[model samples]
Target: MMVNDKSIVWILKIYLLIIFVFIFMPIITSVVFSFNSDRFPSLPLGHFTWNWYDKVYYDSETWDAIRTSIIVALSASVLATIIGFCTAYTDFRYSFRFKNAYLALALLPPTIPLIILALAMLAWFSKLGISGQIWALIIAHTVLGAPFAMAIIRLRLQQMDKDLESAAWNLGASEWATMRHVIIPFALPSIISALCLTMAVSFDEFAIAWFVSGLNKSVPVVILEILQGNVDPQINAIGSFVFATTMTLVVIAQLFLFTKKPNNH
Candidate 1:
């Protein structure tokens, strides 16, 4: 038994190490390549420089794309977060018919192939005369992101105690007052998580944005365009910046959630 247990432990450890390396190898390679001084990706390793980073920062087109992406991400995240909060709150706080079906539908977007949805949206948009506009992209992104936000908020709401709301109501507080004063406070972390996740999704979204964004260019669309013509260190530089930004935001959000002062009402 002891030998079998030892073998199993070793196997699990090896498996975990392999999985970790497999997942991170591309990321590590990309980060390393971002600092490569050579114009070509295959250039030998000791040529490190800051030129690519400078180019990434200084290029007007790249900056424009980045600005566009940020605007779309912020808009879509805020819209999706609000829609998701309302959806989750309704499902949890009230009894309704077809609630299961509603939740299943909410989760369907992430499960379905993105290509199919993008194509469908493209067809619909073509008929509506608004195909390829920023509003089109915003609507697509909101639909894509709201489901995920709802699911996360629902999970967090489940973990929350309902007595707090009930107590607030019992104190002669109105429903709106209880929600504003009590429910929203407790759900802040989940709200922040949903916002972060939605922003990330909107920021990196490619397929739907490609279809619905029309002639307007976003960072991902610009990145795709850049890739079609040439392979440059700029790709790695942009990726490195995205990676760094994502990591920093995730760290800050986690720390804020975990270290926040508890609400003692």
Candidate 2:
């Protein structure tokens, strides 16, 4: 039997709605729990309260975890963005030996299952005597985050106007000058997107951080540590804050992308 176009459209809409609902269910629950006055996150809904959030704000340990997470995420994201931009720029602007091989290798890190990647990182860092070090977490996150940054920036670089840089060079601009004057401004949106994504990745990183963390913990690692003991609504509270900020940045990155799109019009 053949389906009508309207029927297909309705089915597709329903399917998408179902998918989105499933995707957001955990987030919705977490947000709800964050506001719950209950000691633990469970049903028999407790009185509505913002007490958990207040705790999250005032708790010194929470702040410490946040600080550690911010430091690692910022460091990793910046390193990733730099390396990603350089590799992407090279792939787009020049042809070199083993170019395809190198691109494949660049993409390889993200392809590894993160659990496996974390274990592999542990082994690698152990050989270098860096296991259980804070920098080890940063390095592992950089490895994962850079591939995503490279993927985003690479696509943006490909979509950029080829003539602009050439025009700058034709006008006697140095390569650095052309990059600064013509390319960087054009690629700014993609750069922002890459940085935001890497920041989120680094912030949420768990397996690698669990493996490589010394005395310090990323926010996710801290949460995991807390989970081992009594489960608290504060976990949900802090989680809500974490989710809000990271997702907000992701949304902003997406908006910036809309502004820098290739003029297909």
Cα lDDT tens digits, model 1, 40-127, are 7674685878888898888988897788788888899889989899988988798889988987887788887999999999999889
Best by TM-score: 2
Model 1, residue 7: C-alpha shift (Å): 4.3
Root-mean-square deviation of Cα positions for candidate 1 versus the true structure, in angstroms? 2.4
Evaluated at residue 248, the lDDT of candidate 2 is 81
lDDT (10s digit) by residue, model 2, range 1-265: 3568889999999999999999999999999988888886678999999898887888888898899889989999999998999989999899989999999999999788889988888899999998877788888889999988998888888987788889999999999999998788778888998999899989888888888887777789788877888788888988888899899878877876667554434
60: Cα error in model 1, Å: 1.5
lDDT of each: 0.83, 0.87
- In terms of lDDT, the best-performing candidate is 2
State in Å the error of residue 88, model 1: 0.6
What is the alpha-carbon lDDT for the whole of candidate 2?
0.87
